[model samples]
Target: MNVPTEHLLILSAILFAIGMGGFLLRRNMIVVLMSIELMLNAANLAFLAGARQHSAQAGHWVAEGPVMVTFVIAVAAVEAAVGLALVIAFYRRKQTVSLDRLSPTGATSKAN
Candidate 1:
């Protein structure tokens, strides 16, 4: 059974919007990181949808989309690792994950 490509794209768009909203509105470092991940997953959905649509039209799927998605997932994993490490280090120094509480140097500062 095949699903409609437009539906997948719509879902992807929705996920990306929600992720952007969370990233912009949330103050916690971890939540921001999670929003970034959600955006990445939305991109993956778009890639898969494109691949499926291509397969439907051409009678065979190209490996490009899935291969690119694999690379994206790898990059996302690395991003999450580095982001979490920074968040942990910041929390260790400032005792808070709130972005508003952090200074440019990752230290605590008076909120303006």
Candidate 2:
């Protein structure tokens, strides 16, 4: 049975919202990275949903959606690598992964 496109879109929206909330509310570097990944996956879901809907119309194919998802996955992999590397470096220097502890100017906040 084919699922409705609206359902897929709604699921994607919920996933994206959850990811956004996690990314914004979490302080740990790892959780933040995971949240970013979650957001990417949600976007991938949305792309696939759109493609499915398009392909259902008059035998029209939508190849770009999967291609875009592939690109997104590749970029996400690179982002994870670089972000983890930075996290490692920061952890080595500060021994903590709290976002509030790391200043944008690379200065460490005073420990409370």
Candidate 3:
């Protein structure tokens, strides 16, 4: 079954907005990473919708959308891996995942 391009685009927008909100409003590093993933997924949906619309115009489904999304998925996987590693390291050093508590250099400054 074919779905309308507008509907798909609207859904993508909503997903992106929700992800953005989560990314901005959440303090936990893991939740922020998940929010980033959500945003990426939203982008993938938009790409698929565009490809589907183009395919509909040409009277045939195209492979470009899925191909591009596959690459994106790979990149997102790598991103998630790296992000999780960083979060784990931060937790190990600080014992907390709160962004406000985690310093940039993981060092504590002492005033003399």
Candidate 4:
């Protein structure tokens, strides 16, 4: 059984679309983060497909592209950690993580 490069490109596009939809529709910060990660992976897939179709030496580097992806993943991990920590702290004071409830103007009150 042989598959075509165009099929791979189509699959990548579909995955990217689904990821984008998930990112936009979900309100929970954690789910949104996962969706964003999915989108990144979809982009990586497309990058590799293009690299292969063009017979570019850079395509071979596509397999190595995960090193950069790993760095981004690490940054995302740190971001999630800090963001969740902030969320917890905010919830402790405000009791909600909903975006609508978060306000920069006088939303936080100093605990005496």
* Higher-scoring candidate on lDDT, 2 or 3: 2
Kindly list the per-residue Cα lDDT of model 2 for residues 1-112, writing each as its tens digit.
Answer: 4899999999999999999999999999999999999999999999999888888884988898999999999999999999999999999989988887788778766753
Clashes of each: 0, 0, 0, 0
Error of 3 at 92 (Å): 1.0
By lDDT, is 1 or 4 better?
1
TM-score: model 3 vs. ground truth: 0.91
Q: What is the lDDT of residue 29 in candidate 4?
A: 62
Off by over 4 Å in 4: 56-86, 104-112
Q: Report the C-alpha lDDT of model 1 over 44-99, residue by residue, as the tens digit.
A: 99999999899789998788899999999999999999999999988787788888
Measured over all alpha carbons after superposition, the RMSD of each candidate to the real structure, in angstroms, is 1.6, 1.3, 2.2, 4.6
lDDT of 4 by residue, 22-88 (tens): 8888766667667777777777777666656655544444444555556656876787788788778
What are the clashing pairs of model 4?
Answer: none
Worst 10 residues of 2 by lDDT: 103-112
**Best candidate, TM-score:** 2
Which residue segments of model 3 deviate by more than 4 Å? 109-112
TM-scores for all candidates: the values are 0.92, 0.94, 0.91, 0.62
- Rank all candidate structures by their TM-score, best first, as comma-separated numbers: 2, 1, 3, 4
Deviation (Å) of 14 in candidate 4: 1.6
Give every collision pair in model 1.
none
- Displacement of residue 43 (Cα, Å) in model 2 is 0.2
Evaluate all candidate structures by whole-model CA lDDT and list the values in order: 0.92, 0.93, 0.92, 0.69
